[model samples]
Target: MTTDLVAAVDIGGTKIAGALVDGTGDLLHRVQLPTPAGESADRVMAALTEVLGGLTRHASWSRVAAVGIGSAGPVDARTGTVSPVNIPGWRDFPLVEGVRATTGELPVTLVGDGAAIAAGEHWRGAARGRSDVLCMVVSTGVGGGLITDGRLRPGPTGNAGHIGHISVDFNGDLCPCGGRGCVERIASGTNIARYALAAGWRPADPEGDTTAAGVAVAARDGHPLALEAFDRSARALAAGIAATATLIEIETVVIGGGVSQSGEVLFAPLRRALREYATLPFVRDLEVVPAQLGTDAGLVGAAAACWSDPGTFLAVGAAGN
Candidate 1:
């Protein structure tokens, strides 16, 4: 008997990564493709087809049972349509069905990128064997997903994990969502750079937008402006976390993504801010840690979604069957 394998795809603004993942979450085969910029949905799908075609030719066809996709924001897992803000021309595109058309009737699963990360962590990373966990990706934006009572909440339309939209300050900066001060508007990678720019923090990468990672590096090197920038980001993130903890009381908050790679530069200040602001004693002790899977998380989580039955998560799938 052949072991069942799942093809997992992680689609981001910069690139698309795919892997053949086994039941144990081991990557058997991997492929990377540059995501076309400013292209129509058809062109982007063509790029994906090229990569998938190559991967399928190399791997055993009999063992591949499913295809799983983890895509950026505004994706509906049930419908498998993607409408990422960063990726132009992908408004409600039939991403899962498009990929499935190439897979010869194999089962295809779709999930929010942030939710996929949370599931990936629970499967093999920081949140493994943990039920109540809030996984956050503080990279290009501060996105998050929730796992509560040993169940992953995809919510209606699978858009439940838009933690970035959570408001931190009622009268603060106006968000793109037309709200006052959303967590993303203040603490996300894009907004962090925006704050740095407003504060006149110049960088050697003049043409490039000064990112959160750049600010963290500058702070590490004792740049006062960068230090101030991180301080402000930390405050906003901490306040958001505190509010989330008050509501959910999760056991841990796992932080990942590009900006989170700053290590102590981001975590230390985040913890300090969290401790200072978190009013509840229970919320203060909520462990904030780095994600273990690193870059492979999105793929792994997508695979996990496939392993889960339709409209169900891993735990429920396992028990029901």
Candidate 2:
């Protein structure tokens, strides 16, 4: 019998990537498209359909068994309804059924973007051999996924891993989630710039703004304000990670995305802060490292989701007699 092919799609705030993948995590027929900003859900669906059609037409796969989607937040994975705050048009949208209908009756799996990343890491990335790990994406926004005992924990409807929203400061900035002191409101790239601006690091064109990478460069070049901003963000992230480590006793924390590109600039202070905060000696040694798969993580993760059996995405390490 011929091997089954799966279609994996990862939808982010800026871009959408999809690929045809085999069970062994080999991705083929990759394609990418810009996510339509401020468009209605139907229009977004149209965009997805167009891209999927192009991919299906170009790829020479005999049979497509399933389609898996890893979408931005507030998605109900059980019902497949996506209500992401970033995607205004996606309120209560039946994403899995919608994709299924669009693809003509193929099985569709809808999962939170965080869960997808975790699944990807579990299947083939940094946490491949581990049983408990946290996969974090620190980009425009900070997102997280949890895999405990090698199983994906999506919480209720795959939205449980909103680590960015965890309150780091009691009297800090107000968040979109109606909370104060959310980690994302402070440490996300957007907030990093916001904090930098608040500290008087101004550019000629404020609207054009500085990126996390640019800030890292400026910090390395001896910009005091940028260095302070990075320190503050790192402190917040480390605190969050320490708290997670304490609560869950995680084995590893895998970080990915744009901010993580800062390399040691981001990791050093984070490690320092985590060490300072983690009172327990065991939690202090929790491995924190950059993601191995890089940009392909989302695609690889989506494919992992496609191959996973629902409610049992976790893998158990083999028992030694």
Candidate 3:
């Protein structure tokens, strides 16, 4: 029997990854390349084209039924375009069209990276079996999505449950997104490291270990400044999660990404702070947990997006669950 597959692509600021994924959420064959994000739009597309070319040359390409792409976004599924915040060259770039052109008539599905993570978690990861969920990626930046009524609701612009940019403070520092006291401004990995450094939390091995992971290690060792930084970031995340729950009544908040790798350092304080902020009756019972898919969430979620009716060039969505 021939195994059916979906070609999945995950495009982010740092990397571009693609895989041939089966129905049961397994990545069969994969390839990765650093993204030329700082290059011209054509140059970036050229790199993406090279990725698809690799997939097409694979022996299993014959069984591929569809193509799914999850890109760092402020994507417009309505128009089959993307304007990812980190990739400056691709403002309203016709990503769907470009992919379609690459893979011929194969149906392509496009969704924001946040929405992609949501679909992945809801379909098979931490938020599995939950009808309502908020899946967040808290790495160099914070991105999130919503799953409601047993379905991924990526919304019109494919950036619906973007809790990262939600204002948690009115008189706070300015975020690059032109917002004040946004969740990303406080809780992202970059901000976590930034806060620790600003507060004189130097790492024991100061060569290149001053990142959030280093902070986590220091926090575990009882460093006051490092612990304080994680706590502050957790507080901001708690506020954002509580706000989202208050607005739409999500059942679970699934946290993933680089910063989330801190395990207890991030989750322990986040749970404590969530209890303090989620005061309302309905929002109080919200469960916060780790993501099961780890780094594969984006690729798996991209494949899942193919099942959604996000109105790409071709309407066939496989949702290979």
Candidate 4:
């Protein structure tokens, strides 16, 4: 029997990746290009076009039944528009229309990267077989998606599970999203490094590294300030996770991205802090695990968004809340 396929696009500030994905969530033909984030919107579109162009050249393209897009957001799935903060050139950009135009008007599904990640995990990764989950990526920025009752809930605006911007410290620091003490402000890799540096945690080597990975190494080596930074980030993340569980009763949270690669450094403190914050009986059993799909999650999930049963993609009525 011939395998069916979907064309998937994962778009972010730094890169545009496209793939032809099979029904089993496997990528067949993949292509990538750097995103000209600082350039004009047309330039970014051109890059996306190039990615789509490459995918269409593959022989498997003949089997592609639909096109799916997972974009750095805030995207309005309702209107097929996107406004990613990192990609300033795409404020309310017509991403769905653009992709449709690129692929001969094939049916296209657009979702936030976070939502896409959640769908990927639910379909084939750590959250597989689960009915309730929260999937997150904690790298340059923090992003998240939700699975409620086994369905991918994109909400009205396609940003339903945006745990990053949710305020954990209302009076703390101001977030770029105009919120104070957002989870992203305190828990992202960028914030982890910033906090460690500001707390007098200098890199081991003067000319070495100063990124979050550097801080993780320092923390493992017993740097007090570096350890403190990770602890703080873990605490903030725990609070956000607990809040989400409190609201919707998720069973597990799968974390991905560069910062999550810190492994025990991040998870140990996170589990400890979760014990303190997730005290409710119903939420106490929630599990926090590492994501299994890694970087391919966005693409796979984008394809899943197109291929999963229609009932699984139904929007939750109050998802926007």
C-alpha TM-score for every candidate: 0.90, 0.91, 0.93, 0.95
The per-residue C-alpha lDDT of model 1 at residue 13 equals: 81
State which candidate has the highest lDDT. 4
Residues 106-189, candidate 2, lDDT per residue (tens digit)? 667777888888888888888888888999999889998888877777676776567899999989878988999988988888
Best by TM-score: 4
Better candidate by lDDT, 2 or 3 = 3
Q: How high a TM-score does candidate 4 get?
A: 0.95
Candidate 2 vs 4: which has more TM-score:
4
Worst 10 residues of 1 by lDDT: 312-321
Q: Please state the error at residue 60 of candidate 1 in Å.
A: 1.9
**Clash number for candidate 2:** 3
Better of 2 and 3 by TM-score: 3
Model 1, which residues run further than 4 Å from truth?
A: 1-3, 203-209, 309-321
Per-residue lDDT over 1-321 for candidate 4, one digit per residue giving the tens place of the 0 to 100 score: 353788899999889999998878889999999999988888999999999999988877777777888999999887888898999899989887777767985677888999999989988999899999999999989999999988788776778899999999989988889989999999999999999999999997998679999999999998999999999999999999999999999989999999999999999999999999999999999999999999999999998877547423322221211
lDDT of 3 by residue, 155-187 (tens): 866778888899999899999999999999999
lDDT of 2 at 288: 91
RMSD of each: 3.4, 4.6, 3.2, 2.9
Model 4 pairs whose backbones collide:
none
